[model samples]
Target: MNRCYLTARGMTVGYDGVPLIRDIALEIERGEIVALIGPNGSGKSTILKSLARQLRLLGGQVFVDGEELQRLSGGNLARKMAVMLTDRTKPELMTCRDVAAVGRYPYTGRLGLLTDADEAKVDAALAAVQALELRDRDFNAISDGQRQRVLLARAICQEPEIIVLDEPTSYLDIRHKIQLLSILRDMARQGITVILSLHEIDLARKLADRIICVKGDTIARCGAPEEIFDEAAIRELYDLDEGAFDPMFGSVELPRPMGAPRTFVLSACGTGAPVYRALQRSGEPFAAGILYENDVDCRLARRLAAEVVTERPFMPVSDAAFERALALMRGCERIIDAGVEIGETNARMAELIELARQLPGYNTLLN
Candidate 1:
């Protein structure tokens, strides 16, 4: 049996006969959450719209569950797939429940009236998205976040085998974003294939099983999150000449402060992250060190700090690394001890602290 629930072959997509992206091919398995990520206007939405049959494909074809998407009847496709796009069309005098009930149209009788069972599913879907309280409220009167949840409820009530969403987290608060993504994760576990475009690379990294990077007229890269979220890959994918993307944290840092080191930061463990960011925000070129390559601090320092002296993880602070850090420290006007736990393995840290005290303008961050 074919495990791929959705397939796109030679898919060329665009607006008004002009191709924005060309020759796209994808095979998304059942229950996988695939996220499309790229720069704005990179055609992520265009690809999604074409797949959902909202836009006419300039070329190629889409298949859902072994049936060609274009060949499926409207009702047949509605039963198998649900799409939640960004365009919100308001209906007159319709309650949130009424909007969600529209999803039941495919399952309803010829008169298009929802049955009690359909209402129950609508209520359940609303409850799932924590929007049950808005069920009686006018859809047009709700906030964007609330409306997004309600629309998600509408899609959920459709009971699709696959769901396609475009930037679904727009206008949602951080909490709602988490809640919505959690709901999608839950849905995927139940064998619902989820395809969505997300501007939040961090959220995409966390939520997507596979990530498709849409760039410059084609699908540039498509693979597991681990393969797609590398520092170099993300930097190249987004054309990030400024700023740095940390794959480990799924975070982006502002460009490093220009010029020579002004402050020397001594830190270990994860303590240096905030200091690094603070220094970056202040546009202060800083040197940080005696950090292990695997240290969380080291990861960020490499991006924000003008100079970083790193040692291998689980190894004692080496003499060469200490010398390099000491050289950087001597050049800086101020030294900040961002705190470290003194242990037998890194006893050299104590020596560095003692040396820092001899230098002018040395301060400890910890109590």
Candidate 2:
């Protein structure tokens, strides 16, 4: 069996002698990317700091490469693990290359001079993070996304066996977020252990080889993302309402159906799939109106043998189409709007909502 890179047994973490993470047990192996996630103030950061040896454990032990963490010297610990903390304060006038070079300090001589090999490693790290072009730019002058990439480069330059990042993507945009995580995934594949804290559960689910979900200062669930993302587990951990989390898409807030039905569903586009499926499962009768040929929901509606009033490709909503949709709604006990993207041109749908609101016995199920 491969030896674990980091191990914690019966661990309790806290600050100023007050325990926040209680009796936690976890093990990370080489080449694994572990995501630590939880609600705010749930001690995810505290647990990370404890693993990085920034905070003393209130109880239990943390082991790196089979040695107790507390027994390692500062330099020894530095060589074994590199930490990219959440609260990084950039110094004015410092170049990006200068900041990344600091990771070489642990291996440098007393004079703090970078040797030829050190420079090569720094350059390689910058290249790895796609920040080579920003190497000469001032750290404080760069965007948050660029600065985050530089920080990651600095951690890579440390050449440690393990890297711990606290909210590494917090400062990045969508593009940079994907870039940074892709780089981390590549690093993990190269046999380095990677662990990070994340607020974006979807990203965590996609990237993490293992997930450690903390809730109320304890381990709520810890396993593969597939195992942890079940409805019961997510609802319990996040205190979400029933039907709030969609297992297929990992969305927390499901669109609600507004007003009572009279005849059938007049929904088109992908936005209507969830509501259409729900209504079908509930055995409620619905019809489809003014469906576009390419809309997936229209196909589903057709499969369900729903009374469909369809239009030709790229055709305008004719008088016949409008009449058909209106006729369907007239028979519906209620009308439902399932996250249909409304625009100024879609004012008729808004009018439908108003009309439904004025009708007696109309109600919406707020999920």
Candidate 3:
């Protein structure tokens, strides 16, 4: 059974004694990665800062492993938790190695010098983040992405039970983002609980075991990724009246073309996704048809196309479905065959193709 590693009871957080968010409640299990996602200025950073003790709580309390957070000494808390905020460290004349070694401060002697074991831990942390090669370089001289990785290395070196990061992937490129997330996933498997704020909702869906949706002064909702990541929920969460979000792909599509469909596309399997996007980009209202309900193309077409004529899954195109598709095709200014294969179940598609060829405005991407 999983244990509650961190808990917030009626917690209120903000800055300067003003509550930005109030009556917040959370229970985070050990070894879980919980991501905070919300629109900008929704108090995600404030909540993280308060939990990590960087900002004082305006009301309520936080507990870690049954110990009240405020009662713990600074060093004791640091030993139990590690934090890497977005605030860039601008220490002059400090090497990357020197910055990473700061994680050992809570464990170091009065002189604050690193022992042999401490040095090894720092080296391992840098290597874990793929920054060992930059250890001797000047900290301020590296790029923002590199600095982010180094800071993560510092957090890893701390060896705390819980790690809190704010926008950890802000400065990372695609490759580095993957690398860093993979490292955090590995760390969590070894029983380190992870908490962080992410602007990338798609990434949050993929990575977090649980998600906390922060909005308008407090947590709007909190649940598993499956419960929180869906078309309606995500659309409402971000107030997306302009565009569409697809949970299957974790992608956002531009608002669908307006007015009536100007083009009719016949596609099946996975072929129509690109064509649908292309038509959307060209601002051409389009329709897709003769697709089974379960076809991958049907999924995207429903989002981008003005109309979609769909048949039942695993069933051949019925006369009713074919008539609807044909009606759409006849109304379109142009008919496009998007490389639908003539197969046992979908053989009626060939008839549609022949009719399209007879029509005046006919195009086939098969060639």
Candidate 4:
């Protein structure tokens, strides 16, 4: 059974004495990756700062491994928690290796010098984050992505039970983001708990074991990704009235073309995505049909087109579905066959192709 490693009970957090987030309660188990997500200015940073002991709590308390936060000495707390803030402030006149060695402060002697073991830990951390080559680079001279990796190496060298990071991926590119998150996942599997705030809901859904929604003045919701990543929940959470979000693939779509559909597209097996995107970019009102609900094409179709004709997943196109599609096809000014494969499951699609060929405006897109 998993044990609660860190928790907050009715915690109120903010700058100085003014509370920005209040009545927040959360429990995290050892080795679990918890992601805090919300809209801009929703106090995600404030909550993380408070939990990391950078900002004082306005009310209530936080606990780590059953010990009250206020009761733990600074050194004791340092052993239990390590924090990396999102601020882009860079250290000057120091090498990347020197910065990563700072995590050993809690274990260092009065002179704050790294012992042989401490140096080994720092070297291992740099290696873990794939920043071994940057060990000799100037901290302020490195790119944001490199700096982030170095900071993560620092946090890892601390060997703390819980690591709190505020927007760790803010400056990272896609490759570094994937690499860094992979390292975090590996660390968690080894029994290190991670708490982080993220602006990317897609990454959070993929990486987090549990998610916390911070909005207004409180924690809006908290649960596993499956419970919190539904379309309605995400759409409402981010107040997305202009665009659409597909919870199935954790993708956001541009608002569909307005007005009546003028074109009909027949596509499947991920082929519709490009056509849907092309139509969307050209601001052409469109409809897509004869798709199984679970197909990748169907996912983009519902978001980009004015109408999407879909059937149950794994089932062949039904008469009712075909009729709806035929009616849509009749209304369209042009029909573009996006070259869906003739297959056993969707052999009924042949009828639609024949109907398209007889229509006045029929086009087939190749490749």
**Top-scoring candidate (lDDT):** 1
How does residue 211 of candidate 1 score in lDDT? 97
> Whose TM-score is greatest here?
3
Off by over 4 Å in 1: none
lDDT of 4 by residue, 202-278 (tens): 99999999999988888888999999998888888889963498786688887889889899999888878898899
Task: Report the C-alpha lDDT of model 1 over 1-367, residue by residue, as the tens digit.
Answer: 6668888899899999999999999999999999999999999999999999999889998899999998999999999999999897789999999998898888999999887899899999999999999999999999988999999999999999999999999999999899999999999999999999999999999999999999998899999999888888899998885447878778877789989999999998888889888988899999998988888888878888888899888889899998888888888899999998889888999998899989997988978
Q: How do the candidates rank by TM-score, highest first?
A: 3, 1, 4, 2
The TM-scores, one per candidate, come to 0.95, 0.76, 0.96, 0.95
| Clashing pairs for predicted structure model 1, backbone only | none
Using lDDT, rank the candidates from best to worst: 1, 3, 4, 2
- Name the 10 consecutive residues with the lowest summed lDDT in model 1: 241-250
What are the per-model C-alpha RMSD values against the true structure?
1.6, 9.3, 1.5, 1.8
- Relative to the true structure, candidate 4 reaches a TM of 0.95
lDDT of each: 0.91, 0.80, 0.91, 0.90
Better of 2 and 4 by TM-score: 4
